[model samples]
Target: MPEGITAECLMENIMEKISDNLPKQKNASFFEDDKSNSMSTQFNRLFGRQKPVHHLLGGGKSADVLLWRDKKISASCLTGATVVWVLFEWLNYNFLTLLSLAIAIGMVAQFAWKTASGMLNRSPSEVPHLVLPEHVFINIGKLVGVEVNRGLNFLQDVACGGNVKQLLGVVLSLWAVAIIGSWCNLLTVVYIGFVAAHTLPVLYERYENEVDGFVSNALDQFQHNYRKLDARVLSRIPTGKFRGKKFE
Candidate 1:
């Protein structure tokens, strides 16, 4: 909230507050503590852990829970999208057209690398240590696994009511169409490249926005969580010892 403070700083402050009262035996880096893990851990633990913020806000304003929820949604959405794009490219790869397929693979790799670099550069304070598997095939398989699980979850939830398998099949079909169409005519290939290239910026922008929104939501969640913890700490004391005292 400070005037000059960057979004990264705000996010760190938020996460620090949220994780402050919890056990830290794992020594896991903060960036790795994603919402998918945190939410799965259960918010109810905030009470058993004697999280003070809960007691403070009980009778007052209702916590604006939307921020954290939205943050998770946004992060999942963008991550899911990138994974899907990469997968679609691979699913349609044709070794018969070696040159085009090679170019496509290179482009996908470049985009993924660029995305990773952009994320790290945006928040230099948040160091993301990417773990590369021992073998290239294993690494690729891991990425595909992420896409399969995470992407499916996103589709089932975000694009609700669609048959996931059918949807994936359709995407694969389109990939084939694009490739085949490209081989049929130079104009088709140029058109495909032009369309996809023009749309790339939009996708990138959407991805960046989702990441930023995720950070913002995380900060808000930390603040709300802290407020609950502060409240709990105050209740244990005698009324006379500290009257209407605000926890800093």
Candidate 2:
């Protein structure tokens, strides 16, 4: 009876021990989950973005079009861009020539409409001439100026920012762009970028978690490799000493 009682007591004690440790094990798992979440957040804030991609892109009609929130509008814009690209590229139409042709066609259509409308005893439709507003041009100039200054600032930062990885990335990107520009005309390059801008952002937003996780993993691996490279080679390179010129 005593042996059997001791065996029961031992079994109860083991159960109690396991019960006692279970919460700690759960807490350890929770801690690991929290750590991983923190790391993911850190990685995602790589460009210091704290807002949604749409908000970062201005959250206006332009953002909607880019992200394709309004499918009809987005599709129309894409269709229009495709038509322009076809006219400019496949049809080999010159910009000035196309403009003149369009104007001529409009004038002829208006003249015919006026003649038919008079015969039909109806009011003729107004002829629409190209009347670009001064304010529109000024607004466009401001936007272009802002973008140009922003680009200049980014280049300056890369040149003197002391972040070797960022500098390397910028250099590689510029080199790649140079190669692409060599292969295609400026309009084709711009059109390709327009298409990518229309597509990539929405996809990233839709698959935010997956994209962030994948990018974080890739970045972590890149940083690990970069650290090794820095340790082995870059760390040994001597920085040049700048000597100031003597005053005359």
TM-score of each: 0.18, 0.73
How would you encode candidate 1's per-residue C-alpha lDDT over 151-193 as one tens digit per residue?
A: 6675444334334444555678779988898666544354456
In model 2, the runs with Cα more than 4 Å from the true position are 1-48, 128-130, 153-169, 241-248
Query: Judged by lDDT against the true structure, how good is candidate 1?
Result: 0.54
Residues 20-53 of candidate 2: C-alpha lDDT, one tens digit per residue: 9999999999999999988669767636467889
Error of 1 at 198 (Å): 8.1
All-Cα superposition RMSD per candidate: 28.0, 7.3
The lDDT per prediction is: 0.54, 0.86
Candidate 2 CA-lDDT value: 0.86
lDDT of 1 at 214: 62
Looking at candidate 2, the ten consecutive residues that score lowest on lDDT are 239-248
lDDT of candidate 1 at residue 142, scale 0 to 100:
94
